[model samples]
Target: MIDLLLEMFSYMFLVRAVVVGLLVSLCAALLGVSLVLKRYSMMGDGLSHVGFGTLAIATAMNAAPLTVSIPIVVAAAFLLLRISENSKIKGDAAIALISTSSLAIGVVVISLTTGMNTDVCNYLFGSILAMSKSDVNLSIALAAVVLALFLLFYNKIFAVTFDENFAKATGVKTGLYNMIIAFLTAITIVLGMRMMGSLLISSLTIFPALTSMRVCKKFKTVTVCSAFVSVICFFIGVVISYVYATPTGASVVIVNIVAFLLFWATNLTIGRIKK
Candidate 1:
């Protein structure tokens, strides 16, 4: 076991993969709590598609995919927030529309430009094995920014999540907070795309939060537990992928699902025993 671990840790790529995975997991766990509470669980899905579309466009234009994706994702996030304020189009509908459109655009653009390659598969399914030092640094920077934002607006975020009207009545600028949440979501989705893929990125935002909520009642407890769970799953998944020569993103997502199931089952059993 010790030899195997040392072997896994010896490679620079593996080390980078681990760092990126941890950063993505931490940021996703933090943002996911509010997403679930606000019933915006699908927001990750939307932003991921937005990221994918931007990536495709960037590829076609010979630009860096990350650079292209970030601005577009942020803009889409802001637009979503604005649309939500209208109250005419429900949040779910808006998300669905935007998400589907963005994904379709991505698919069409890729078809017209690159004609598909292994890179497309990697992007769609995740490519932790392909992680570089630069990717790790980018993930770290994004996570740091997300953490700083959360710390700065913790109270206002708490209020918005629990009681938006109360926050608005108290002049908390709920609209701005809503936009900030969306922007953060976009950033998380973009960074997460490489680790989790456009297809499974939502799991990073959903499963951890769901599993933590099952076992913890307090909001802070949920965040702490979820982040812990996310990191565990990420590391375990990377190890499994390395050992089995499997797709890292899929492996990580599977680990997260297993954890979610275990938590959910345990909750059910305890509830039955209580009864």
Candidate 2:
């Protein structure tokens, strides 16, 4: 165990991996809080597919995937928000349509691209082993931006999440706030794609929030606990992946699932005993 720790610390790639995991987890936790509260838990999944589609197109054009994907997904997020507000299409239905379309487009684009091994499986499932130093730095910057935005809009977001009608009554510009949340969700999905992949990235945004809400009674407590749990789960997943020679993203997600289930079970048992 000591040897593994020392080795992980010694390697630059391992350090990058750990840092990327931490930053992505923090971003997911922050966004997860609002997502869960708003009952938009599937938003992450939809944005991730949009990110994947952008990545595929970038790969075909021999451009930087992150550069291409971020802006596209952000724009798509705003469009979705507008559609949600102006049309009768339900939020989940909109998300489902977008996600399915993006995934289909991504798969088709990848197939048409020549000389690119389009590792759809890795992108779908996740591949922490593929993380680079640049990716880590980008993750850190993206996470910082998301955190800053969340802090700036914390009160409005709290109001909107709990009661949109009340927020609108209080002159909170609920539509604009919802749009901002969607924009941030898109960015978070793009940033997290490398660590969690398009398919499983939503887990990072959902599990920690779910676990924290199960145990914490207060909103502030839930936010803090979710972030803490997210960090711990990411680290554990990375370490376990290194030790077991498994895919880092899948391993971390599995760890998150296990942790969530354990906490949920404990919460349920305690509640029953209290009764």
- Reference-based lDDT, residue 66, model 1: 75
Per-candidate TM-scores read 0.95, 0.95
lDDT digits (tens) for residues 152-187 of candidate 1: 987777899999998899888998898888888889
Deviation from native of the Cα of residue 21 in model 2, angstroms: 1.5
lDDT over C-alpha atoms for residue 193 of model 1: 91
Task: Indicate the TM-score of model 2.
Answer: 0.95
Kindly give the stretch of ten consecutive residues in candidate 2 with the minimal lDDT sum: 113-122
lDDT of 2 by residue, 107-152 (tens): 8999887433647777787776656667667778888888899889
